[model samples]
Target: MYSPNFYSFVDRAKSDENGFIEFHNAYVSSKMTNSDLYFVLNRYGLDEEQKDFHIKISPSKTIQPKDKQVGELLEQRLSFEKNIPKAITLNDNIKPNIKVNAIEYIPQEYNHNSFNSPSEHHLIESITLQAHYVLKDSHKKNIQGDEQSLLKESIQRHKHKTKWGYIVFDRDEDIEQTLKQLNKTQPLIYSKRFKELENIKGEIVNIPFKEEWENKQIRFFAYLWRANRDVGWNYEYTIEKLRMELNHLTESAYAIFAKEFIRIPQLREEYQKTIKQISNEILAIVDEEKDKSKKFELAKQYSKEAYLLRNQVLNDIRDKSSEFARALAKSEKPILPSFESLIARKMQQNNFMGKFENLSLEQKTKVYRDIIDSSKNTRKSVNNKMIYYKVFGRTFAIATIAYVSYDIYYSDDRLKTAREHTNIIGFGLLGSSVGMAMAVDTCDINPICYAGFALLGSLVGSSVGNLINNATDTILKKYGYE
Candidate 1:
């Protein structure tokens, strides 16, 4: 009832040595859940013929002229999306028999992100590493310094890819020609007359940027032509050269470029044709419909078809960042001078990343440091202002004692001299002790007990101090010396 589409590959060396090929990297379309699809494949995967449960291979490439090495191994991302026989058992570890098919052979080019999807950090790291290998020989020939100098120079050598998307090289016009050719080709595809569609076809389309050679043009739109893993554009030097420059321009041409510049646009044009054809069909149906009652139902059916078709197209186009663009987005210029003014030479060329993604490593560090410092200052200010329960209780006690002493002995005219001076000195001591003994380490005080004690102490101290003051005043007033 169900079949799966897989992105598959073969490693001949491992197969020959191990005597069995595995489909570990096999994945279905992004639409299907892996758990559901793989469970079915693991148990029920069968050959195209359905006689034996096996993978029927199509010959992707026979010989690589550039590599000058010929073998059974075809560098490819094979897609499996056909009927398969039901499983004999439900075991997950069951292996299917190998079935092979041969076709016109094509060469494989290396795509960096063709394998396990890597994070931005990992992607940059991989690009820098590969660049190092490319530049190693040149570096050795040019540099002959001390070990420390060599290490530091090596650090400079492996800088991140260029930030600017466009660079002006002596051969830029050559690339521009190719770019223009790529842009103009697609509109022509969509404008094909019926006679032209039957008579003429475009060349096999592949992303020129992902090729091992410098960017080149292709004629036909190759649907789902994913590059193999291993190589990137042999323009590491070009990227490195452009990166080290202080004045590389951000490209607006890529935006200005016409519809056929990328495969996504071509797919869009194809869908546009499908939409127009469906609309024309709906009109024809309207003309033929004699029964007026059936018109509404027919209109609803046509609208439903249009909605489904458009949504499916959008799903195919959505969130699919240009894998080719990612491959072309390599640049390595390490020296970041003043980030405040680095907006012209900014590292990120697109809006693909978060706020931090656009910023350089230097800018991020500076922003975070400022945040930490501000936080520290805020915390310190809060801690200083916070009056802990113990501190508040002690201060209140000191204030009450001072208040009582002033009201009684200090204010009394008939009070003995010793009592007056001693009470003044005691008040001073109590105030000093209150300031010194109170801890204000944080904005928070301890438990409810401390808070309760502080509140109760304030109330009781005020009452007792007032009572003492009243009694002392009465005694002083009744005395003859008062």
Candidate 2:
């Protein structure tokens, strides 16, 4: 298991020289070092590129804050998406850092508004927030003496405070418990973790990603936190706060990442043989390319082509994901990701479901990659497209080939007149070409598979020849022209 721990707490951060809001009192537990939780959350955090802002404006423009354009600037910086946040900092990699500029609301007199905005307490210009990527650093435990000072400072700063507005994330109670139970049983292969995963996999196999399973997910993470309780987070500080924050944004991709990321370690032993074999094949091919300059040039061309294709694929993925996220955020009713279509693709690709008992950790990893990388077009759209070519293009070619092959091979056979041959060829058996259609459809198998088309053509030609022979016999007797 990857077994990375996660911990989150809200607190006031220090302002740097540039005066960006930096949270120091995350109060992360001792065992779960700042690095693990930091990297995991940052790995699955709301990416800057996916962050869309919903700005709140007040009508009382008269009593504005000192920084008039600051609010506008904040919106400009935060609202407009940037590239995906980087996971590692240069040289020093203790904790993954996000470079975001966040504004802590120092609220003053609140202006009230009722139209358009759901927020009743109008955000008076007194509170201005700056925007930057959030950065994570070393653990800063909130000391006992600091609590009172911090509270006093908060009240003093926002003396005329208006309303409490913070993003609250919640997950269901049952789900949290289930995750806890599974985390407890994670050590053994036949333990409850496997069972719970199966349950979740089944439950989320359809549309309307249900609430019950989401709760399970929450419980899973919560318990995963507790799994390292002795070394990481203890029950005293985190569990209650975790339980309180029940309504988390469920649609995000973090949980899926966490679940799949853990399975990576599980695949190491199972795939050793395959990896070694692939390495040997690669070495052999490279060794065969003895001409140094020629090999270098050929390799350079392939590398350049691969790089171009990768860029195009990544760009398309980002565009689609961004579009889907925006639409889902605006959706009236939201749910977890069912990912059924992705799961079906994985199952079909690896044939994972064919023999559940035979599945090893490596095969499981392959299946997981299939689902996770579906957006990246990991599998080709071959079979789904083959039928179309068969119907439209190959079917016509079947009959034409049959005529030419039969004429070339069997010109000595009894066919007296050109009219008779034409008449015979006119009645082509379109339906009898299914075998040829299937063969051409599976051209990936081998070129010989296309010989089915030849057989189809020959059958057609033979039928035409018989019709011509019989028809000529009838016409000669009836019209005396033959």
Per-residue C-alpha lDDT of model 2 across residues 183-211, encoded as one tens digit per residue: 57464223434322222111001111233
**lDDT of every model, 2 decimals:** 0.31, 0.31
Q: Give me the runs in candidate 1 sitting further than 4 Å from their true place.
A: 1-210, 219-274, 277-296, 300-482
**Alpha carbon lDDT at 384, candidate 2:** 36
Q: Candidate 2 has what TM-score?
A: 0.17
> lDDT tens string, model 1, 86-155?
2233322332111111111122222212311222221111221111112233345655667456644333
The all-Cα superposition gives candidate 1 an RMSD in Å to the true structure of 32.5
Candidate 2 stretches greater than 4 Å from native: 1-431, 434-461
